[model samples]
Target: MEKLYEVFPCSETQKVLLATYTLKDEARRDQKVSEFQELKQGRMSVAEYEAKFTELARFAPHIVDTDYKKARKFEGGLDLEVFDRVGVQKLPTYVEVLDRSLMAEATLAAMKQGKAPATTTTEWRGKRSGFGFKKGRSFVSKKQNTRTSNSSSQSSGSIPVCSDCGKRHRGVCYRVSGACFRCGQPGHVVKDCPP
Candidate 1:
């Protein structure tokens, strides 16, 4: 009787352990799926966002089982400006969508810097230069000329030219090659500069 009681308790404990293990795995998977579904591009660059999306996507394969579905999911997570630009293309494959999103990001950045106009999607698709402008007459000539004048004035100590990038600025040069003004790190801007 004593041996029978010990055997039954040991088997019950093993069963409980197995059930707990299964439940833990299912719970973890569920969490990962939830995170994947809620992923967004907020504040992150396109490459960072894409890497995270790929990392979490494996947990929820059914959500992106088809190429179209995968592309759509990726598109939906882009920033509003990039999404609007890329969405208009109606790209067929995930790779195409990803490529267009990267281009859109570059174009938008150029626009923000006054280097490109807010052109139609058709114009954007027509031609592109290394600086994300439509190829033709140099649109940057005016800006370059202004910078040259400013630099010449800076030589007389009237204006300040950033020694780091040779552009005119009043205070710390925060916009030079996207380096942090505080620490001079290349990957982050001033506001996101780490202590």
Candidate 2:
């Protein structure tokens, strides 16, 4: 049998005692002893931790997943060690940075009040809209994704438009503008842009 402390060393003494008491209460309240027997035996599945849960999007908005896919191809950029707690097999690009690693532990614990671990095809990212930069980083390319189109880079044109605000300016937008030699501003040449 696994030691209680080994199972949950982080729980406070009082909390652990209460959890055990609660489990006993649940056992008595279940009204289905045969169902409980399945759990006691190996027929039931065990719960998983946060890292694997988040990596695979198995858990709820338990944690945010960053666009690790946009990172560079370098080994340092493909850091998946952080998700080791849960056996999540995620592409290096699907990981997200979290403020607190332990937060997932709590979320998973609450969810696992005891359930089986099942493999799921989890889509951690949100659906696309017609706006905004495609993703957070540069590890992966859009050419490799669903929005695959020949990048604007391949199209030859005398000018470019700011993807944001759709303004017309030249010689670099004062802000994050996709400006070109034409129509990036209000009736003015970039050379004559008021200083």
Candidate 3:
């Protein structure tokens, strides 16, 4: 009777506790922790990547113990384009970084579709310049004239004509159809084409 009790434990709680301890797999937990460390956004969208990140994060609590650490860790796994856009904002929280990454993904998608305004590129550059020009100043006038000339040359009949295909389109001709600017191929871009 004493030997059986020693083998099986005495009370129900003790038996359950012993079984739970016996089932715990330290190697499996370590594998999860390693997976979290190697996680990347890759081809996944921001929401999908976020779901995976949350799922894995639980296995590695010490790495992301603080809000800032968690935010940085999340940012580090973003796709290159999204990471570049979100990194420039220097957001302080995980939520802010995630939101900005989503926004950046949308903006990139719009740009790829040629639905984004041409001014968006110039406006972003202007904001980053950190030099404010007064209205009617020589510098401002020059900048405005350049923008006007560029837009006027690019616009025709409400739809912008694509320089690549010489066709009237709402968005970029090459990007909208995913064609190479150089060889006009769909699978690759101009940079990878032979001259």
Candidate 4:
């Protein structure tokens, strides 16, 4: 009470009015809950979502009490891709969700930068051996493969691996020579790389 009085620096009547002013009115509480329900983690960072959640929770703590409920709520607002990646995760608490969400955001960012997102490739039938050329028409140069074989023998096994994408292949790596020098990724030149 003394600390409050000292910090506020107000008379008794003023303090009473201030206290009433800071009181959580029912109308404001309902509004906050509505805002919380509408919250989405679209373009904002996870930190921003968490901060907003914290603010709104002050008005409606009941809505986010349990770990399951809190985690679900947090997942609901995530960006489409991030939400898809982390949605199936069974987080135990709001804090766990926050931490995992940050990790998911980082992964999404890395994926945007051209790093392949870790995903299970169950359907291998539809997948191609490497970028460019149909099956047997791949462009591995015989001279280049023979000369580079001893020097760059990353794959000692029977399955030949491409230097660019690291995928196994039978013939020359079509992406090896013509890869974009600027981005260092296969399949496109520097001028064709995304802006």
| lDDT, candidate 4, 26-56, per-residue tens | 5677888999988997778887888888888
Sliding window of 10 residues with minimal summed lDDT for model 3: 130-139
Task: Provide the TM-score for each candidate, comma-separated.
Answer: 0.55, 0.14, 0.53, 0.48
Which candidate model has the greater TM-score, 2 or 3? 3
Identify the leading candidate in terms of TM-score: 1
Residue 69 Cα positional deviation in candidate 3, in Å, after optimal superposition: 0.3
Clash counts for all predictions: 0, 12, 0, 2
For 1-195, candidate 3 gives per-residue lDDT tens digits of 346568766797777766666557666788899999999999999989999999999999999999899999999999999999989878887866876687678668766866533344454455356332433552444556566546645644555466777786433255655767665445678879876
lDDT of 1 by residue, 1-195 (tens): 346546666576777786688789999999999999999999998878999999999999999999999999999999998999989989888866776687677667756755533345443343333222335644444455455445445444533476887975443345644556665445777678787
Quote the RMSD, in angstroms, for model 1.
12.6
Question: Mind giving the per-residue lDDT tens digits that candidate 2 earns over 92-174?
Answer: 43222221122233334434554212111221131132222333643334345334223332322323465654664222343
**Which residue pairs collide, candidate 1?**
none
The Cα error of candidate 4 at residue 5, in Å, is 24
Off by over 4 Å in 2: 1-83, 86-95, 99-107, 110-112, 116-119, 122-195
What is candidate 3's CA lDDT for residue 75? 96
* lDDT for each candidate structure: 0.72, 0.34, 0.72, 0.64
lDDT of 1: 0.72
The clash number for model 1 is 0
Task: For model 3, name the residue pairs that clash.
Answer: none
